[model samples]
Target: MTTAVDTRQVRDLAVAALAWVSAHRGDFALGADALTADGPVDLTWKPLGELAQTCVSVRRCTPPSDPLHACASDLLDFAWQQTGRGELFLRLQRTEPFATYPLEVYSVFAGAGLRHTGYEVAAGAVARSRGWRLTEHEPTRRLGLLNAERRSGIHRPERFAQALGRTWLGGLPEPWTFERTSGYALTHVVFHLTDWGRTAQDVPAELAAYLTDWLPPWLDTCLDAGMWDLACELLIVAASLPQPIDAATLQDPWRRIARVQHASGALPLMASDPARTHEADPEPSFVHGYHSTLMLAFAAALTQGVPV
Candidate 1:
């Protein structure tokens, strides 16, 4: 029987991947600078394709042989400072040699400050520490036809723990994996400003969209519904609105992607079609956070037009 891996080992493996990618920031054979203002890394923003490329590159470069060796080691040391001895690895074996990570993921990470100080420092740390173990809850059966269609080969998402010594303000996790965490924090800043009676112009365009399209419906469905964790997703989306939010009430912009679950357990937003929703996924929370953050960021960009 194949042995299931432990969480710490998985963490280490993940750290290794981030190190490889970080050290190889300019090298796609491991890590290539993922974000560029004008275009995709490979000039094609396809994530599936990028994964294929990344897998091939990583497989080809071993720890000792790769120039990123020292960088990777350094990252691990940093990681150990936070979480201790985590193991990480790709969910899939490297096979296709030509695939590269899509620029969007890289762009998203970079735009969100994945590598800079106070950025997702946990990219390496998480990959180094975290705890987990397997348990048998139910029988499993392979999805042959469905799996074939999704191209969803089994590659586990890179997960990890906070490194030990590094302390961020307000006890926030570094390199937050889900965009929702960061988005919500940013959103609260905007909300308090808006609720406290701040001017719309004071806000960023990145957050503007949410003021209309995202806010009301989110409040309608998420708050009214009992699903609280998903609420985090909604808060994050709020962060992406642009400056000078358009005059809009909370109810106007909901695409009504799912049924609203207010006052009870039913969520209308949840029932809506995924494609029609702002972001496509099992839950709209993540998509909501993503779009909100993006819109707010765009608003920040508009400031560039002004004479500094």
Candidate 2:
């Protein structure tokens, strides 16, 4: 018999597993957790080399009316699960959950009202992960399942690199991350996306306000290179977290991309510079950008309130 919580968890995990699979088609395959016409799928954050492998049935989980391989609810679940999974969510989203799922995943919903289902699942998943009852260190266990390529791993910046042609120039690369530079922006997004509960009030008004305005940069990564998917996700996350910034900030990322007037399709992907860090030692820089930014921004917003 399914308890209310158990029933909710299955539905929630169903969506989470779906989003996890789609967003990380490569990782899911590496982990061999991709859902096929088989039975139940077993998954871990790590790749199954030998002991990790498991036999399973495959099943195609899809809707007949929907041709899109992925769904919004699953993406939403993925975002929520990432947040719940803490750093995994940070690594996976590369921006923020709320920004990614509701804003971008709507295409999967096919214009249907996905409001209730998505919200319910997202809230449930996060509560489990971020709940006060759980210790802060709880998420580190996922680190155990991590693969060696954290440099080249899914956690590495630019795991989702896209190469496309530009109008005059022909071809260009759009990278997703910058070693030490993106920390402030990343943390601001993560802090806002978190459930600070009523305690956010304890964080001070000035610091809170900076988190609002300072986020515009993540939306404006580079003038020519752009990432609306990440921007929308940042926006969705901002809205879900109920930040001070308005939807106007969300428009900046898309606006920049739209205004570019590129003859070829815009190449929107993670930032990458092999010389810089995020890839060298995944441990030091993983969420360091966001973490440091949040702390510094809070201090500045509270005391100085300057970009520094």
Candidate 3:
């Protein structure tokens, strides 16, 4: 017989994780050189965008009565204000008309109803340009861009199915061939297809079936390896499946993550030893813990029956 997962403990984990993010919201600020031509958009902009994206997921998954919903809303407000209520996005789009990062980042806020008409108009114009249309991206990234376009009210000429077909996951590669890189890629393919689990039914039937069959073992391996960050993501993917895996099956995995999570709610990139539960670090690096912590909260929120 399977033991039931502790619902209260899962909710507490989500609460603590969001608390950590709120305390470190200042760290998500862009550097002074962020707006420059040679800006480190990947470093500065990507983190902030991911923050907003994850906040959106949290907010969407939790009910208004839930503290997590309020926490996520606050974070989204902070992220939008950081972009100067979208003024910075308009400027970045103007300066780099062909750049896709600005639009992609802006799309997260826009989808949450924190829009800037000026940025929208500018992005729309750029979307119609030949240069923008011809810009190249890796298949997974291309899927994200197309989804961003659709979110921001821009035209999406490419069919989602066509985009999916171009991805490694869409091809339904051999399960045995799964590795670190492919693992991340396939998770994203599912995320982009389902809008971070808001629409789990959006996942193709075949893909959902494949994940249902293989995800449990993969999640087990990740937890066993103490790959906390990737394991959190896989947890989210598990919750996103059409027929989500039994909560009883996840009791052990959740307990494993809880044991490694710092008192402040940060998670290291990986545990030092999978065989032993290590003490939480007194001071964890923000760079190492941020993504994993956010993913943990997101997964926890999804576990509360947020995803349809």
Candidate 4:
């Protein structure tokens, strides 16, 4: 029942989303001293990381001549200037349970920002090294660590490959399910294995086989549940597989997502449903739509192959 993705529609949605972020860049900014409090720091990290991911993906899909290219570049520069200090690490160290799962989460996106922006942060490097040292004690975070390294372009292939070899993906808790956190983790593993779709040939045969068999059902389950963010991540996984998945299978989800995007370019966390509420609070927080919007941008860039 699925149809081919309308490439024009995808591009249009991406353009709108980028324009929204550009216009609201001020709201998304992480002030130099913004990490002074726990609530503020956590809020700042989420949107900043999301925007950085979008910027990187947008850059991949377009040429320098594209209008979005300058916006993405400028935004990354501003983000780097804001958080490149040791503040992120300082905040992490003071956080509860010293080596918590949140540290791994922050590392994954922060590293992605660095890798995509090509901005060098000596402080970030120190923080990542510190985080890596901490993660050695948490086996549950192995996949997270691998994702951070790969996305940040700081990976050790032999070590990472060995880690992947030892992992029993099927044995992991609800390994391939559509639950948000764990599901994202699973997709991140596939992404790292494939080098974010840049080197599909590098995907391990076992993992690729597993995804080949399971991804379709998983994608269906996520869409059925209206888990758009996770669905987008799954789309990236499907696209990165060594043998391409049929584009038609992904078209429906893409169109559904585009239809739900607000006029301001922000894609909602979920599609329209009378039971769901979609308005921002009195003080509009950028975090509300950050993930879905970023995911849409990433998906569009990946699908539209960058101009040569």
Best by TM-score: 3
Task: Report, for all candidates in order, the number of backbone clashes.
Answer: 73, 27, 0, 0
| Candidates 2 and 4 compared by TM-score, better number | 4
> Which of the two, 1 or 4, has more TM-score?
4
In candidate 2, stretches whose alpha carbon ends up further than 4 angstroms from where it belongs are: 1-27, 30-204, 221-237, 240-244, 257-268, 271-308
Residue 298, candidate 3: how far off, in angstroms? 0.6
Model 2 lDDT tens row, 1-308: 11211323223323332333343333333222222223122333322111111000001122334322235333334433332323322333333332222222222121122233343344234333434123232121112111111211123231111110111111211223432234323433232223111123332344445446544564455322333224433432333233434544433433342332112221123323323312212212212222211221122111111111
lDDT over C-alpha atoms for residue 90 of model 4: 45
Candidate 1 Cα misplacement greater than 4 A, ranges: 1-214, 243-308
Q: What is the lDDT of residue 269 in candidate 3?
A: 75
- Which sequence of candidate numbers ranks them by lDDT, best first? 3, 4, 1, 2
Consecutive 10-residue window with the lowest summed lDDT within model 3: 275-284
Predicted candidate 1 versus true structure: per-residue lDDT over 1-308, tens digit per residue: 01121223222333333433343333222222222333343432332223232322222223455433344344333332221111111111122111222211222223212223221232223222333112111110011111111122212242111111121211333433324334344343443223211233544353354344545454445444333334423432332234322223322222221122121111222334433334333423422322222221122122211111
* lDDT for each residue of candidate 4 in 1-308, tens digit (9 for 90 to 100): 12377777877877777777777778777665554444564566667766765676567557889876777777766665555532454455444333433344345445444432322243235435655455453222465456654454554443666656544453443444446666776776766565456667877777778777777788777777667778878877777777756777677767766656777787666644523323321211366677777777777767765221
In terms of TM-score, how similar is model 2 to the real structure?
0.29
Query: Could you estimate the TM-score for every candidate?
Result: 0.22, 0.29, 0.94, 0.73
Q: How much does each candidate deviate from the true structure in C-alpha RMSD?
A: 22.4, 19.5, 2.0, 5.6
